[model samples]
Target chain A: QQQVKQSPQSLIVQKGGISIINCAYENTAFDYFPWYQQFPGKGPALLIAIRPDVSEKKEGRFTISFNKSAKQFSLHIMDSQPGDSATYFCAASSIKAAGNKLTFGGGTRVLVKP
Target chain B: DVKVTQSSRYLVKRTGEKVFLECVQDMDHENMFWYRQDPGLGLRLIYFSYDVKMKEKGDIPEGYSVSREKKERFSLILESASTNQTSMYLCASIPGPNTEAFFGQGTRLTVV
Candidate 1:
């Protein structure tokens, strides 16, 4: 029950369009959800995050839409650009997660076409 | 800037050899983690440390062991390097539970 399943292993989006990545979890204990963006030769960095009490949080072009009852959360990249092409990971963890452990999804390789 | 740094960017070792991957964080965070990244596997936690001399096995820790002698440094050791162990290893640190994790560039290990 510690798995976070992500879909659309790979995505291709036209520039100036919207890029969406979806993720689902099986655990209800998860209270915090964060999305990470990783470049080819770099480590992943925190992009945006949300708490279970909030339905959605937006930060510039990146937004996290969370659904508590459905056990799902998604990352929506508005005005997608080529520079946004990278592997995106969605993770879930409880406030008291062991070692602050995060359960990550397999990932989505996003390609923004110019 | 606060950061997590890995000792090596790339490493090559022969099968049956001992391998040690080192990581250090300057954030003085209480939580540190080691994960292996593969093509399809997003990031599999190998081990993590909450404090000095404290360690916990993660999801995949069968052939791997961890050492946390200090608060800022965490090391991952491979008992016997094997070809299957070749992958990108990443280190991360967090200030506390439910916080964002800072990661190192990653060490790509190749076992010959």
Candidate 2:
């Protein structure tokens, strides 16, 4: 069973628009949430991360909105650009449990049209 | 910067043959992981090691084994290669909990 679930297997947006991807987890023990971005032929890289203690965290054009009660978190890309097109994955893990291994969502492919 | 390096970018092996995928990390991380990536399936952990000679099974450990003889090197062994095992394999390393994990370029293995 997938401990974490993500939606919109794929997404398409225009330049200067906003692209959002959402993920939900069933494990309440999870405290650390991170988003990874992967371009074709490359490994996933850390985009941004947040803890349940915070409702939201933003880094430049990327933002992570977390809802502890809802057990969901979403990634929003502002001014979506073609350079931002890639596969995005949301992951959750507990620092004190299970070696802190990340449980990743199915992943969402994002495309930005120029 | 942390760097994780896989032995190969691509490999082709015959069914029933033994295959070894090697990964090395330069950051001297205490945690290392092996994961397989498949379309729509995301990344599935095959095995992880917290320290030398200490390993744990991830969500998917069947048909796979691991060895961490040194803190910097983690090896994944396929006792008997199968077509079903063909996929993109990624190696990651993290200093510890709540730390960022760095991934390698990935090795695409194909079992014929």
Candidate 3:
């Protein structure tokens, strides 16, 4: 079973516009949600993350809006630029003694047109 | 910054050959992971090691094996290479189970 599900396998946004990606998880045990950004031929890097206690968390131009009751979360990138074109992944994890095994969504490829 | 380095950027091997992929991390992390990324499949974990000499199978560990003799190094071994195994392999390390993971560039392997 896919514990996490992401929408819009591909996204196209105009430069300077708002780009949003959404993810939903079925596991209530998950307490941590993280977004990862990946460029071509490069490894994924941590973008932004949020915990269940917070409804929203913002860092610079990146923001994560989370809804615990809905079991949904979204990533918002303000002022989207061509440089922001890449693949994004949403992941969820819970603290476990065996180690925090992450459940990841398929991925969304975003394209920002200049 | 934590750095994870894979031994090869690109590799080509014939079918049935035994292929080895090596990864090293500089952060002295206790946990290391191996994942394979494909066009639409994203990243699928092959195996992970939480400590030296300890390994756990991930989602797709059928033909893969792992070894971690040292804290900073983890190795993924392909028992027998096949064309379907061609994909970009990534290595990652995290301080522990609850922290952010740092990833290596990747190793693009093509089994002919």
Q: In CAPRI terms, where does candidate 2 land?
A: high
What is the TM-score of each predicted model, taking all chains together? Answer: 0.98, 0.99, 0.96
Error of 2 at A47 (Å): 0.3
The alpha-carbon root-mean-square deviation between model 1 and the true structure, to one decimal in Å, is 0.9
- Put the candidates in lDDT order, highest first: 2, 1, 3
lDDT of 1 by residue, A37-81 (tens): 999999999999999989999999999999888899999999999
Worst 10 residues of 2 chain A by lDDT: A91-100
**Shift in Å, residue A9, candidate 1:** 0.8
Best-first order by DockQ = 1, 2, 3
Q: By summed lDDT, which 10 consecutive residues of candidate 3 chain A come out lowest?
A: A95-104
lDDT of 1 at A108: 97
Off by over 4 Å in 1: none
Which CAPRI tier for candidate 3? medium
In model 1, how large is the Cα lDDT of residue B38? Answer: 88
Evaluation by lDDT, superior candidate among 1 and 2: 2
Give the Å error, residue B36, model 2. Answer: 0.3
What would the DockQ be for model 3?
A: 0.67
